[model samples]
Target: MNLALLFGEDFVSAEQAVLTGRRLAHLKSVLKVAEGSVVPVGLVNGDIGTGHVLQLTDTQATLQVELPEPPPSPLPLTMVLAMPRPKMFRRVLQTCATLGVKDIWLINSYKVEKSFWQTPWLSEENLRENMVLGLEQARDTLMPRVHIRKLFKPFVEDELPALLKNTHALVAHPGTGTPCPVHINAPATLCIGPEGGFIPYEVEKLVEAGCEAVHLGRRILRVETAVPVLVSRLFDACS
Candidate 1:
């Protein structure tokens, strides 16, 4: 973990926190931190700063925290993605958070398996865990919001239009006429399909809902691969 992400429960007082579990193990085995060592620390959805080790033991480590700096700026983007395979979901969500994507929508597509939503990774606890991993990797503290929509048409017809308001909306689809724009660096809403890409009807619905269909060249990419490429191409805000 690049940064120790502390939750409200991890704090004992305004400036003190006790680390246990994975964090304590990381300090012991990976960092080999001793008393008086200062480590990078940040509170979840709060600030980025440092923590001075006040005590270190086998079970727990106490730190005096100083949160003086704000976290990195988030990307002005909202990601609307078709649900991917269970095995790849956690990695994709973490990657999105790491890339500074603050709003994510996991919607159903024709190619998406019904069993995909059954994955434990979609649970609130598991989602937060994976997001925390991503935040730590990026040294960011702002938590990303994940919205799940199992019914595709209702989401597209009812919700997506308002979500696209005042934003450059695009759907990444292979074989499309328009190439994906680069470095728009403004608020945008991007919709990506599953492994096989969205079916014609679904693409039509999204386009009708305000997204301009665009392509990322002839080579079709996996959802995980396309996420980073698309986000980077659309924005340069990520550090």
Candidate 2:
């Protein structure tokens, strides 16, 4: 964990917090910290800062926290994606958070299995857990929001158009005519399909909804691989 993400429950006072469970283990074993040691820390959906160890024990570690700086700027992109395989979903969610993607939509597609949505990772607790892991890895405090849309047509026809308003919208399909735009660095909404790519009908619907279909050359990447590649191409994070 690059940052110790503290929640409201972790705090004893305005400037103090306690670490336990995985974070406590990491402190004792991985970081090998002691009383008086300092570590990077951040409050969930708050700010990034430092925590000075005040007390340590097997059960918990108490810290004096100082939160003065804001977290990393979020990418100005809304990701609409087909639900990936259960095994890959958690990692993909985490990857999205780490990459500064604040808005994510998991939508259905022709190739997406009905069973994919049954995964426990979609639970509110699990979702927060994975997102927290991602935030910790990125040393970012702002939490990402995930929206689920199991019905394809209703969402595309009913909701997607307004979402695309005033933003460059694109769908990533390998054989499409236009290449995915590079470093546009502006607000955008990107639609990516399932494992075998979107059926022609789905692509057409997305296109009709204002997304210009685009490509990332000949490579057929999995959903997990495609997301980061497409995001990086769309914006320069360093800027």
lDDT (10s digit) by residue, model 1, range 51-106: 99999988999999999999989999999999999889999999999999999999
Clashing pairs in 1: none
Q: What are the RMSD figures for all models against the true structure?
A: 0.9, 0.8
The residue ranges of model 2 lying beyond 4 angstroms of the native Cα positions read none
What TM-score, over all chains together, does every model reach?
Answer: 0.98, 0.98
Clashes of each: 0, 0
Worst 10 residues of 1 by lDDT: 230-239
Question: Which run of 10 residues does model 2 get worst, by summed lDDT?
Answer: 230-239
Write out the backbone clash pairs for model 2.
none
Error of 1 at 221 (Å): 0.8
lDDT tens digits, residue span 100-214, model 2 = 9999999999999999999999999999999999999999988999999999999999999999999999999999889999999999999999999999999999999999999
